[model samples]
Target: MKTYIYKIAALIVIATALHSCEDAIDLEPISDIGADGFYANADQVNLGIIGAYNSLQEKQFDEWVVTELRSDNTQLSFDNSQNANVPYRQLDQFVSNPLNEFTSSYWRASYKTIGLSNHVIEAIDVVEDATLAAQYEGEARFLRGHSLFNLVRLYGGVFIVTETVDASQARNLERKSIEEAYTVIIEDLEFAYNNLPDSYGSDQAGRATKWAAGLELGKALLTLGTSDSKVRAEIVLRDVVSSSGGRLLDNYEDVFDTNNEMNDEIFFAVRYQSGLVGLGAPFANLFSPRASENSVVFGGGDEFNVPTEGMESLYAANDPRAGVNFSTSWVDNVGNTNFERFISKYNSDFGNVDDAPNDWVISRYADAVLLLAETINENSGPTTEAVDLLNLVKNRANQPDAVATDVDTFFEFKLALEEERRKEFAFENHRWFDLVRNNRAVTVMNNHFATDFQYNDPDAPFFNTAPIQQFQTLLPIPQYEIDLNPSVAQNVGY
Candidate 1:
């Protein structure tokens, strides 16, 4: 996973703000005490970088923006009720809603981080050390790119702003075309890739590395090509050749283990300490069930996002990952060992504590490998090499090898691969995107949900029963963005 530096950046900002404001008589203007003035020394520059990293915390703005609203996972049931609190469940063609709290929080949080990244990037150039300046700049770019990628994927075409704007002006910012938005994202990743160090040492162990930028760039290219055939061939070639350094780990599950952040497979990750002073934890409380003894005493036990039956069935029977990813049967709060199923990969013995110290992986080598295989299959067909790569992941999951014989006949293999990804990466936020990319969402979801699935068939079965429309594939532009920016048009049918 790519190590995110924004968390560090956020901490620096808070510290700087506190120190600078300690004396009321120090009459320096706020703009005069800008990042350039503040980052004049190495220690200050380091703090600035740390502040950037701090922005990644859930409270600061990264979690809900990137993960909660994303399509990858859904909330589990609350007290045996089938419906979860996630509002988008209704938007997903399975339920109904007037926008739930999760969706609203996610939108607000994403734009907040975007604003923070813009502020940091605009101020960092004042540092005296050339190398330090480059590092901070690269970190800022990575954060901006990372945030924008989520925005585009979720909203389709989002406003692209490079500098901080007042609330009034921000509201008026127009949405860019998807192509235009991707162009900026590609550029930011490329800049970060060129300027970032190949590796971050002990002090910067979890910071973004060159490989993280490469992975994001490659994925962005893949997204672009998927939407535009004219750019497809070159983008795939570029991605495969440019990202050779990123290789899958020997084991699939190892990538998610708390101790695996330093593994070669990680490209970028959001760092969370067990009890860092300014740093906040997001996953620690969410993963543990209410009854677990280790659960955090205060805000723990919600288990808001639970894996669904469809997600569970995606794994082959007896696959090792099945047990690791979720627990169909576990000892309940009373030590009865109830056989209830819930997401287990994120479970930590820490119980309901808010700071269990598991870092969220944004990108991993396994995804790179699977992407390489899928790209090869899409562009040329299943080859010996592609099959070998595909099986490398499957074999790790302790499942049967893929039986795909030719590239043209690899659709089943692709389906299987998608299913494997759903199981392997459940709750990490990859499912909805996978369905969209493969164009299997409507059909697969209809069958899975037992509703009539049709793209635009008014007479289609379950038209009333299943309220899904094709346009639901792309989420509605947040109503806030529509209200703020007149140039920002809503998605079709919204």
Candidate 2:
């Protein structure tokens, strides 16, 4: 069993947390503040941290809709065949729907985690051991900062809730500016990097570490897109590359192999269990061909996050990632003769429905290496050091790479960096944010709508509808949020 699999119910959470979306954040003060005091020891504080991880698992499952499906990486397998998949199709085509359930659930789960982490941060002072107290606080802060970083990137502005407020106050919370959100994210991650441990024991495999926080902090700085921020990011990311004890696996396929769990390459991942414990991952079934029956996995696949044909061409001629990430067709397990393609990263044999033990790897050394290359390029144009960094991942995949003379200008190097990241992180939920980070979402996606979307879903709205506008890059504030919190207005051009 994966460590950190504590019963989330051990944490003091509201009963309605997982299902409620009416409020911006749901919180309730603990009823028993008895003689022992609130969260008086390390174990109690750890429960809240586990609860935050639980919420992260829920939040991250929704990321493919907003990030991968919307990007050129993936799309709906059979857009017209699945009626229940309309919301996914809408996101795939960039439709104007503010009430997408996936979007709302993602928003609610993120704040729900922030609320739980806030409780941990506020209650950690009572722990007697200073080191444990700081580590616990750092973990909580890291979770909170991670949530805020994703929120600000996906939505232009979002409500900021540092302290646990009464559930009644949810209606009154106001969305803060993107600048303010980044400020809190940077501050929290900095604290996490300073206080978190460099590594965890064998029993605790997936707990947040100093290396994870530093990578995240560097990413936030790079996303902020200032010259000085890029320089600062370069310093932090370089340290993660050299001193964080992270190393890439020899084979690209081994990175996601179920048998090689928690290998040296993975820096952080949301661990899952395979028994009927209600804590296992759902991607194996969710990403498989819906009609594959038992051929792809136990039960039937949901056929979500299907890889696009366009994604196949993004890789180089000899690139091996396409074979590892996805496949072209499969025999009909139930004899339906289906050829739908699903992401193969999580193809482990599953028992019950949506109950596979594949850990959702959130950060790895290869990702950090590529981010370092990006920072190096942004700092100095087409530098040899930057090209060398890019070649590290390329060489692993057995693909041809430039000699630094080929990419003479900054723009060429930038394109190379983006393409490398595109293939390396395919179906890992990093595409849309990457485009926005490079300020190429509008141009690249518009071209996709005109060309690729036409090839994939030519009958969809693009035949008569318009491509995404500049303001539409930020997802619309879910209408359900505005319904509950009137003070929180919808994002512009929704």
Candidate 3:
């Protein structure tokens, strides 16, 4: 990673805003007085926006775990005796509680990000340079929309805070309708797509770009699910695919190498540095099997989200990503061989057990292209255009082409696209959302539970499985937040 990436972490302190009352769910206690006088110069505004970017890292791990573990891609890796890790087990089992700490922490982290981005967006008008002000606003709005998009998808409707607010105002705020929240998300992303630059110089890499907004906007619109919105998504995503000047890497493994941090395929990534500066990403350390348990895997981790047998079975024997994404067997440091599966995609030897500098890519060109294929198929059933797009990804992975002849109907094409996405993006925090978006979360999970539930131990308490209720798709509102503000209502069946 470059030095400027670390600068993002260093500038977060300047952007932390302190609110008067600490208990308000919408109010952040960190002071934003810096925003008052901090927008006078372009350099200061740039630093402030970097601070807002750093906020994304605050919830990255929880976001991935919540999305991935809750879906079919993975299962909780803790032993039956490990009571300390029960919250994660509950999440994997679809019985997460309102009091789960991961739920509350992720919710608070998201709000904190929204608060910081609001500070930047609120102060941008003071910037004298018109071009710089527009750019800053675009960046801030993109960040804010990105945060809100994640929130709505995870919890349904949530408090839509666009501007900085005092303690009293925060106390009175309530959750907006899902449509209302998405309306704001679209508006912000539209402004971002229009104003953000198409690309940046080397020193300014990893910053949000016009294509980032376009891709995210397309995803948000697709999530909203209307004929017009899906059409619009196809158009926006097609533009990103054609003009973004990015493509699938020749080798899929190169895309994940720690030395190749921001490759051509990456549209945006959370930047990190691995040394003693304390800014490296923790995925490597946390994803690796515990050092004492499997030293050959390199690095130490609690091994929270191990890949499931179903996930392992998704790929063909010749698929290159299969080898890079996980390990079915490995030799321990002590020369004993083990057959347990573990995620190997983020492995990096650069940092210590606590920190590894592997950058977590949030979006990439292949993902956007695959999404484009989906939207195209959704708009018009089983077109060659969509088949070609899917094949492009398969070709890059050295896998056989998906026979379009077999996909004669819209329903069949949808299933094929879903499986491609599942295999392409497994363990990258996209499985749960993919299942939900396709309206298959309930059916797929219930079916998976019928046969694969209690995969580690067939006699475990939830050994058989319960049907996933429709309302359970949206997580319960954290009990801590509801207690703080009685104005907020909990999601049904909490």
Candidate 4:
């Protein structure tokens, strides 16, 4: 049997003690009590900020969870009608309602990180060093904005807490409108872009940079403008101009290699150090299958995410990215041979049956370039510049250049961009959001899956059976949260 280092009860006791002692301490009176105590100096601020990064390392945000939600993987189940197991590739059918623990964990983890970031931002003023204080605040803002952006996209409207709210008040908080939520996200990212340094020194590699903030802000603005009014469109375009420095890496395939984490294209990423205090499982082990002989035992489990045929078909034959992103076969170090459709993008070995030290990229220049191209095309019909940008991505993928003989209409350009995004970012936890934002999820699902897709069904034990609506685009407020907080209103269908 696999050994667990810490028992669940022991972990719970340690966590409770740490949080409980926060209110009772302050006898020495270093900084303000509670959250403020953690940010008294530069080192302290760095540690606190890193803690926020650690939140992303939770199992729920790991590669398994991300890949499972991608268009590539199918949720497998026993088929009662067929008397055998069948691959249920329909995401909407399984993703709805309060039963999805993956979605629930993501919702809770994002807010927890946000709460930690809120603490850091509030405490920055108490830091005595002016320059250091500004830097710390900028980093905190970036973390806060990034967390909220992910939360908003997944849940639509979420509780927007600027300051440290009482746990009690946190429960009673109301959901902000999508517009209002994006406004705050933009504001925080803008602050980060202005105050953060252009690059971190060698000592601080993997930390947030000004360009990182810009890329994130640009993406946030681009997403916000998609479904909103013309005013939001104008605002996002302006932000895009200021944020995109027009610097994209020449090679896209190298961006995923562990050696390239420090490449200019990588804006911000969560740095993982194996054997460090906060270090945990690496992503490669999570996506590599159990039956594969080439696999390593990190987190003591089989690779959980296997790419589907539909996802594999998106790539053209002989595309370089296909081999680099995943491996259908491989040979081990000792001359042993193996074969499987295993994810190799996050491959890293730490020489033990534990998580390896591999960083997860949050924002990258390649994504920025593609997103800018998409945004420009959406606002105006496909232009030569837009085509050039899109082609740059294709060229890196080792595909023939994309040529648009004629300028397509806005909607047509959008469809083309969606197809490009699906191919370029297949397993990066973006396809679902892309479909939802474009208002094409239902249409796409209906077209692709035919009679297999159903969402929001109360009659079925696994999901809510209610009819899908435009408003159902957002996920329901998690049931446990609503149960705990009486004031919390459920999303339309719950």
The ten-residue window of minimal lDDT in model 2 covers: 11-20
Model 4: residue 95 alpha-carbon error in angstroms: 4.7
What is residue 338's positional error in candidate 1, in angstroms? 1.7
For TM-score, candidate 1 versus 2, the one ahead is 2
Local error of candidate 1 at 122, Å? 2.4
Q: In candidate 4, what residue range of length 10 has the lowest lDDT sum?
A: 20-29
Residue-level lDDT of model 2, residues 145-213, one tens digit each, is 998999899888998889867657777878899889988999999999999999989777788999999
RMSD of 2: 2.7
Compared with the true structure, what per-residue lDDT tens digits does model 1 show for residues 1-494?
33434454555455556322121111121244554555566565566556555655642332432343234344334343334443533443444322444444555555545555665576665666788778777877888788788778766877788875544666566778888988889888878877888786665677887777777776777666663532453354345335546666667677777766657777777776654444445554564565654432335455555555555566778687777777776564455776555666665544335655567777777777777677766776666776777787878778777765433366866776687677666776677777776776666555544522222235533323343456666666656555445577777776
Candidate 3 weakest lDDT stretch, 10 residues: 12-21
State every prediction's TM-score relative to the real structure. 0.81, 0.93, 0.95, 0.80
For candidate 1, the TM-score is: 0.81
lDDT digits (tens) for residues 1-494 of candidate 3: 35454483445555354443466664453465445755566776676687777767777868876798888888777444546588887787788889987887788878877887887787787788898799899998998899899999999989999887776787778999999998999999989999999888887878889998999999999989999999999999999999989889999899888778677888888877767665667776666665434374345667787887887788988888888888887677778777878888877666365567777888999889989988988899878888899889988878888886778788888898899888888778888898889999999888777667354355556434477888888888888767878879999899
Mark the regions of model 2 whose C-alpha exceeds 4 Å error after superposition. 1-23, 28-38, 82-84, 334-338, 453-465
Whole-model alpha-carbon lDDT for candidate 1: 0.60
User: Can you tell me which runs of candidate 4 are displaced by over 4 Å?
Assistant: 1-33, 59-92, 226-250, 276-278, 293-303, 329-340, 451-472
